[model samples]
Target: MQLDRIDYALLDALRKNARLPNKTLAEKVGVAPSTALERVRRLRESGMIQGYHAEIDPQALGIGLQAMISVRLERHARTDVAAFDTYLKTLPEVLSFWHVAGGNDFLVHVAVRDSQRLRDFALDAFTTRKEVAHIETNLIFSFQRNARLPAPPRD
Candidate 1:
């Protein structure tokens, strides 16, 4: 869908606070409340806006440790990759996973309660996978930008 300045303004307002009332959004974007509501609906329908979620502090939630794991698979065959991807989805501690272009086949974001739990995850879970050949783990010290919207693509 082609987005004009109004649509971009609407998106920016929603990104700041998804729970903002339609009236407030309209005021911020200088549009009618109904227009703001309809624009949001269209954005959602077009898959531009995926979903809204409440951000929670992991430390407060008892998940104090975060790690970025680079996983190298023994074999990069299609079936093997699919099986590994499916297996990753089954692990709750595996918060997010990405398929990358370089040496590592997958990059995974994992969070756990503490250091011990993190170690257990690496040894007991990650290492034991049949298709996993090598793994490198990095402990996250502090996050600079935790979450931010992706910038619109360049023309």
Candidate 2:
């Protein structure tokens, strides 16, 4: 969907804080509250804005360990790939999963309370899969930066 300056401004305000009130958004974008609402609705309809979620601190939640696992599958059959993807979704410790092109077919992000739990998850859960040929696990030390793109230039 094509977005004009007002639409872009509304998106920028929402990205900064999705909880911003419609009145505040309208004022910031120099539009009526109803117009801001309409643009936001259109953005949602077009799938440009997926959903809002709160960012939680894993350490505070007692999930101190963060691990990224690169999984290489034995076969690239469609059924086998689907099964593995479905299986990963059912795992509570798995935070995110990605299918990428490289030596590995999948990259899995996991968080656990400690090192032992992380090891158990890697061995008992991941390695046991018949479709999984090899696994490489790496510990994440810290997150440097996680930022969204800058807002489009206002005309």
For each candidate, what is the lDDT? 0.89, 0.89
Q: What is candidate 1's lDDT per residue for 1-155, written digit by digit as tens?
A: 88877788888888788899999999999989999999999999999999998877789989999999999999999888999899899998998899887899999999999999998999987799999999999999987652455566655
Scored by lDDT, model 1 comes in at 0.89
Error of 1 at 58 (Å): 1.4
Error of model 2, residue 21, in angstroms = 1.0
Kindly report which residue stretches of model 2 are placed more than 4 angstroms away from their true locations once superposed: 150-155
lDDT tens digits, residues 117-144, model 2? 9889999997899999999999999865
Q: Model 2 — TM-score against the truth?
A: 0.89
Best by TM-score: 1
Candidate 2 Cα deviation (angstroms), residue 13: 2.5
Once model 2 is optimally superposed onto the true structure by TM-score, how far is the C-alpha of residue 79 displaced, in angstroms? 0.9
